[model samples]
Target: MSDFLVVGGGVIGMMTTLQLADAGHSVTLLERGRCGREASWAGGGIVSPLYPWRHSAPVSRLATWSEGFYPELALRLFEETGVDPEYRQKGLLYLRVDDEAQAERWAREVGKPLERVSADFLYAKEPQAAPGFDDALWMPTLGSIRNPRLGQALRCRLEAMPRVTLREGSEVTGFRQSAARVTGVETADGIVEGDHTIVCGGAWAAELLERVWMALPVRPVKGQMILFEAPPGLVNRVVLMDGRYVIPRADGRVLAGSTLEETGFDKTTDAEAKASLRASAIGIVPALAECEVEHHWAGLRPGSPDGVPFIGAVPGLEGLHVNAGHYRNGLVLAPASTHLLVDALLGREPILDPVPYRLEGRVTSRR
Candidate 1:
């Protein structure tokens, strides 16, 4: 039996398997589709949450850890795989705040220093933006990464490690367990037995565990994104105007998103979502008005009710652990979440507080 049977192949699952393999553990990763083609692929690749001060302390802690970890991790991955993930820190601009008092309060809550810029400074920094707000807050530490390349880097690096086995096109249908211990995973091909199993399937986590009578409260939140092909440096940095955001990639692609819906697993992009995202992009950067949209797509974020991911061993179940339900901040929290879960699995002290991430009577396997 392998040391771990990880279900799902998004950033969370990929990270879990990657880290475990790094620690000299035998891991087999099972995926329903091509690895990283789900939410991780469609995301805007913003390294920080939008107004992180609004999230809970638990969420913020994981985001903080990942923010510090990604730059170093990306560099190492690029060196190993020869694929540059393009980790860039051009900063994030928050435009049109209601008042300075609110912005300052949020900055204090998040424990991040913000530079307030007046109209002249803002116009000089972002010449493409429409003139409206007199002042805005600039988050210098905020950054972005090319998530598709990041996923590719992870897959390439992991595949080179002999201890790791990656199985794409393998959908997990159920589980093989004894009275209290999970023994294997039931897949489309056959039963793959393992000593332990972890479900990191994002939105599909709940559905996969439900076949085994586990009640994880994870739901799908659909977000649509619009991509624009702009000249290099058309937008200097990531811009947040009103309640929406526009992210400029290093390869001359600007991403504007997204609409949140409770649609169950449906990834269809409608005209209304496309138009709404286009309006948001043009409203902030008037220069984008001349830019044509290159593509439009949707992704499903695994959302929990309180937004804190469920990252602990399932109650009343042995050899079964889970790390899913990260909502919109999945990409930012992937590194820390995977580390914490792996530490817990090995019976070692976790770096982050595990109390807020524990699943109990509400979402136990016995339920």
Candidate 2:
């Protein structure tokens, strides 16, 4: 069996490594920081992104497949790891922000369950919801999970895998290349040798590949969010409006976020961002304004120009692969990405066509 060296320890890397190890391959995972504490932990944990219909066909394909696969994965992980990721179907209440017609048409075309609600129904469902201009769209099957708990579950399962070695706090400084193929990884301590190397480094993927002259257009797009300690039922559903959302955790915490900025790799949370998010949250669900600010933080999403992830074997580079540039849907897309990558590595007929997500090319994500 071939051994693999996987970079980065976020959800994408960890999940992929876990799948690889289970497939009877020896795997070594390197993490620069504590595993799962980065964007994976900081995320809002929505199983489906706010506006899924706007993404490209490849993206939508992966996302739709993932939506069907997550429940089973979550259940299996919980049984084995004793950590519940709190996957729940709280549904989504998309307050009409942009063109309601566009949202409705997209929903029907994509076959996503979107029900139009009268203002009275909206008021009844979320009484504290800020008085909105009439129209509302509700999706009954959208899901969510506590991202940190999901990360923890994966970490625990990975630690118990027989042939998997996880090196936490070990920073991968560079890769060892031998004429177009990556042979191993160079970490802060020493060189860790492997036959195949996969880079899933979120925002840092492009820079790391640049060291080997392999160009991947992955950059850090910072997103800031605020957490509020509200009553358990303060926000019944994921209330989304104007690119911001308020997600309610099972344990009385509501997360309101996030602002997308091309601010390089800076993951700083300023007062303005906090205020903006909180204001958005209150505007959507007025009751949250009284909730105490629990914490505020930021994360760097691996953003591509078109929001499409590079998810196949790198062209001209034998034995090298990547699964990054997920932007806002890393958690939602992790399971499907793993299946897609494991198939590519094991040389099995992939469950779906892999051409659209090939390593090369920039595909537009939104129309």
Candidate 3:
């Protein structure tokens, strides 16, 4: 089996390395900081797209496939690592769905279970919700994961694998090329060589690949979030309105976020954003207004045009590949994205068509 070097220890990279190692290939995963402490750790793990109908076909395909695969993956991770990701299908309620017609059409086309529910039903289901809307769009099958716990489970599982080498704090500065193929990567400590190199360095993917003269169009879109440590039943389900959401955890914590600021890797949490998110959270669930804001943080999502991730071999470069640019849906899309990449790498029949994700002339401009 080919020895592989997987860069970026976020969800995508770790999952890729896990799959490769499970297939009997030796794999080394390198992370600049602690694994999963970046975007992967800081995401609201909605198992579906924020607005599924708003995305393109490629995003839909990956998300759909991943939605089916996540339950098993979460279960397996918890069983192996004893860390429950808290995967729960608490359903998602859209308080203000403007284009219900288009949403219904998309749901019908995609076979996703969606319902146009009445205000009475919505209130009865979630009495804490702020009232006034006549009706709402309900996605009953939608779910979420506690992303930080998921990362912990992945880290634990990876450490237990003999074929996997988990290297934290190893930043890859550049790639060592032999003719047209990438032989290895140049890290902070020393050169780490491998037969093939896969760059999964989330927001840093573009810069890392640029070292090898590969211009990948991946940028960091900063998203800020605020957590409210409220009573357990204050907010029951994931409530979304005006592009922001309030997600209730099994414990008492509720998460409200996020602003899509194209601020170029700045993760500093601002007071304005915190106020806006707090208001939004209170607007969705009135009881949260009194809850203490326990934590506020930001994450840099690997943004791409149309939120479609690149997941294939780099053009004009052999033995070098990327599976980055997942934007806001990294947690939701991780299972299928990694599976597709691994299938292509191992020369097996892919789970889906790999053409849309291929990196050729796909990225016309930086996102």
Candidate 4:
């Protein structure tokens, strides 16, 4: 069995470790801080892309393939770790959608369930939604997961695996290389040797690649979110409108997010963002105005071109791979991304074409 070093412990890294370990490979997951406390923990966990048609075909393919795994994966995690990811297919409603015709055509092409609902039907499904909205595009098959819980569950499962080693608070400072081939990585503690090293360091992936004299397109795009402890049914399904979303949990917690700021690596929450998000949340569901804000936080998404992640071998470098740059859709796309990474590493036929994710053409010129 191969020894693999997975750098980063977000959903992507953890999922990769799980897949590799399941395949009888030994995995060491190294995290700079607590696993899942970054974007993966902070995300709203909409299992599907906010607007599936708006994303590229590669992004859609990964998300669609990953969608099939959540129900079973969630149950398995719960059964194995007793932490319910709270994966649910409650559906997503795109209120005030920009183009119904385009959405319908894309839905038809994808063969995913899509329905145009009048305001009456929309209100019936989400009674708390604000009034005066003419209609919405509903994708009933879409769903969400509580990502923080998901992270907890994954951590628990990984810790239970005999072949998996989780190094929390262990930062990968650089690579251990043999000529053009990466042998492993250099941690603060010392050298950690492995047969293969995969950089899944989320927003910091670009920095890691830079250490190897390589360039990557991944950058840290800051996003902020606000939460409310409203009633369980306050926001029934995942609601998206004008690029904002409100995701409801099983319990009495509701999350409304987010702002896509190009601020580099700045995760500090702003009062302005909180106020704006609060306004947006109350605008969508007026009853939310009655609920006090429970939490306001920010996370750095590993932003890439068109929100498509890089998920293959770093060209010109052997024994090195990467699976980051899944901005916004990381949680939804985790299963497929990890599976494809493992498939490529093990020389197995991939479930999806990996061409779109290669870093050769996508990486920016050296900074």
Best by lDDT: 3
Q: Summarize candidate 1's per-residue lDDT along 1-367 as a digit string, tens digits.
A: 7999999999999999988998889999999898889999999889988877777889989998999888998999999999998898888888976665766786787688787888888888788887777888888888898899999999898789999999999999998989989998998799999999999999999998888788899999999999999998888788997778998888788999888999999999999989999999999998898999999999999989988999988777798889999999889999999999999988788998888898875585545
lDDT score for residue 65 of model 4: 98
Number of clashing pairs per prediction, in order: 0, 0, 0, 0
* Global lDDT of model 2: 0.85
- Lowest summed lDDT across 10 adjacent residues in model 4 is found at 358-367
What TM-score would you give candidate 4 relative to the actual structure? Answer: 0.97
Point out where model 4 deviates above 4 Å. 364-367
For model 1, how many clashes? 0
Q: List the global CA lDDT of all models.
A: 0.89, 0.85, 0.91, 0.91
lDDT: the better of candidates 2 and 3: 3
lDDT of 1 at 58: 93
**lDDT tens per residue, model 3, 196-269:** 99999999999987787767788999999999999988888898998999998999799999988999978999
**CA RMSD for every model?**
1.4, 3.2, 1.8, 1.4
Clashes by residue pair, model 3? none
Candidate 2 TM-score over all chains jointly: 0.95
Candidate 1, superposed: residue stretches over 4 Å from native: 99-103, 364-367
Give the TM-score of each candidate.
0.97, 0.95, 0.98, 0.97
